[model samples]
Target: MNKPVILCVDDEVMILDCLKRQLKTEFRNTYVYELAENADEAMILIEELEKNKSEILVIISDWLMPGIKGDEFLIGVHQKFPDIIKILLTGQADEKAIRRANTQANMYCHLCKPWSATELIETIKSGLKTISKS
Candidate 1:
C-alpha cells in the first residue's frame, strides 16, 4: 500500500527543499512527500496519485506563485478533493486572500513564511486532528 502523501507546492526550489527537510525530520518515513514548482504540476500530480489509489492527506502551498495564486489554487483543489487538508504560507499575507481561502477552500491554516519546523508540524497535526473528528 502506498503511504499517504503530504504534497507541497512552491515556485521556489529552496522553499520546497526546506519543506521536505523539515517534514521529513518530523514524519520520517510516514508519508510520501511530493513537491511541485507550480499549481499546474501539483494538479497533475494529484490526479496521478489519486488514479494510483494513493491518499493525499494534505497540501501545503505558497501564496505567491507564477500562474495561480495559492488561494485560487486551493479553492480549485477543494472543489475536486474537499477532504484534502489545505495550508497556505506567505511572507506578506493579504487578509482577503486568507479569508477567502478559509471560507472557500476550507483551509486548515495559514502560516507566515519562515515557519519553525515545530510550528509547521504542529499545524499539520492540528489539521489532522479535525479529520479524526469528521
Candidate 2:
C-alpha cells in the first residue's frame, strides 16, 4: 500500500502552501500530502487515490469558498468515502453549517482560521492514530 495521505483543500493558495510546509516539517516521513484549490480537484484526487490503492487518512477543507461550500464538498466525500477523516478549517462558517457538516459529513473536527501550527499538528496526529487503529 502507498503511504498514508492527507488531502487539504482551500481556495487560497497561501493557506495551502502554509499547510504543506507545516505538514512536511512536522511529519516528513509519515504522510504524503496533497492539495487542491477547490472541491472538484479534490474529488478528482480522491478518485485517483482510490484507484491507486492509497489510503486518504484525513481531509482538511475550508468552509467559505467561491463555490461548493465546504459542507457540501465534505458531504459528498462522506457519502463516497466515509472512512476518510474530515476536518473543516474556516473563518466564517456558522453554527448551523457546522451542525450540518457534523450530521452529513461526519466531520471529525473544525479548526478556525489563524490556527496554531502546533494545534493543527496535534489534530493531524490524533486523526492518524484513529486511522492506524482502524
Candidate 3:
C-alpha cells in the first residue's frame, strides 16, 4: 500500500531542506515527504502521487513564491482535494492572506518561519487528529 504523503513547497532551497530534514526526523517512515520549489511543481507532484493512488494527508507551503502565492496555492489544492490538510508556513504573510487561507483553503494551521520542531510536529499531530476524526 502507498503511504500517505506530506508535501511542502517553498521557494528557498534551504527552507525546503530544513523542513524535509525536520519532518524526516520526526515522521521517519510514517509518511512520504515531498518537496517542491514552486506551486506549479507541487501541482505536478500532487497529480503524480494521486495517479499512483497515494493519499496526500498534509501540505505545508510557504506564502511567498514567484508564481502563485501560498494562499492561492492552498485554495487551489483545496478546490481539488478538500480533505488534504493545509498548513501555511511563512515568515511574511499578511493578515489578509492568512485569513483567506483559513476560510477558503480550510487551512489547519499557520506556522511562522523559524518555527520550532515541537510546534511544527504538534500542529501536524493536531491536523492528523482532525483527519482521523473525519
Q: Which stretches of candidate 3 lie over 4 Å from their true place?
A: none
Best by lDDT: 3
Q: Write the per-residue lDDT of candidate 1 for residues 1-134, one digit (tens) a residue.
A: 99999999999999999999999999999999999999999999999999999999999999999999999999999999999999998886599999999999999999999888898999999988888899
Clashing pairs in 3: none
Superposition-based RMSD of candidate 2 using all C-alpha atoms, in angstroms = 1.0
Residue lDDT tens for model 2, 28-107: 98889999999999999999999999999899999988779999999999999998999999999999999999999999
**Model 3 TM-score (2 dp):** 0.98
lDDT of 2 at 125: 86
Ranking by lDDT: 3, 1, 2
- TM-scores for candidates 1 onward, in order: 0.97, 0.95, 0.98
Cα-based lDDT for every prediction: 0.95, 0.93, 0.96
